[model samples]
Target: MPVDQPHSSAPDILHGWGARQRGGRIRVKGGGQVSQIYAIRQAIAKGIVAFYQKYVDEQSKNEIKDILLTYDRTLLVADPRRCEPKKFGGPGARARFQKSYR
Candidate 1:
């Protein structure tokens, strides 16, 4: 979708020259802007792969997957890291209350 579209929350990766010419709408939830963008990108990449597999030849499907991986590997793979939960002794994860003796 176009970046100016009201529901287009993700970045304008769809407008890139290598992107699929077909048009479709996507909605992503449960994350910050960066997260949402990544989710949308992965979704788009998967969708393109599926489309190629269904209508195009196997060689083209592999080509699309390779292009996406070359452009950004994360577009096809999710990051495994997550936020460490805050501990009881500290205000945040990996942080501890200061101890001062005078």
Candidate 2:
């Protein structure tokens, strides 16, 4: 809800400053350029996300690349534990954004 804060356990977006860490939230679509499975894995491991699903379809990957051609990479993400903390909570590698200088 807040730009890229992960969805919260409440489903409803947290109402606070635009910069709340909102660690309990997860954003499946990290919308960058070129998805990073390992980074997503780290985020999940860190409880930053509940779970993740990758668009492994080669066509989709290519499409992503095509759409992102103006940039460098794209990032895809998801969370499995949004409404349940006991069912989730840990430390995960935060999502990352990378691009070459224009």
Q: lDDT values of the candidates?
A: 0.71, 0.34
What shift in Å separates residue 50 of candidate 2 from its native position after superposition?
15
lDDT for each residue of candidate 2 in 1-102, tens digit (9 for 90 to 100): 353344222222211212135456445565442233334533433331222114244554444334333322222234344433332233334433454698
lDDT of 1 by residue, 1-102 (tens): 344253333324444534546788889889777567667767877887787789888987797778777867877787899989898887899899997898
Residue pairs with colliding backbones in model 1 are none
The alpha-carbon RMSD values of the candidates against the true structure, listed in the order shown, are 5.1, 19.5
| Highest lDDT scorer | 1
What TM-score number comes out for model 2?
0.18
Worst 10 residues of 2 by lDDT: 10-19
Residue 76 lDDT, candidate 1, scale 0-100: 74
Give per-candidate clash totals: 0, 18
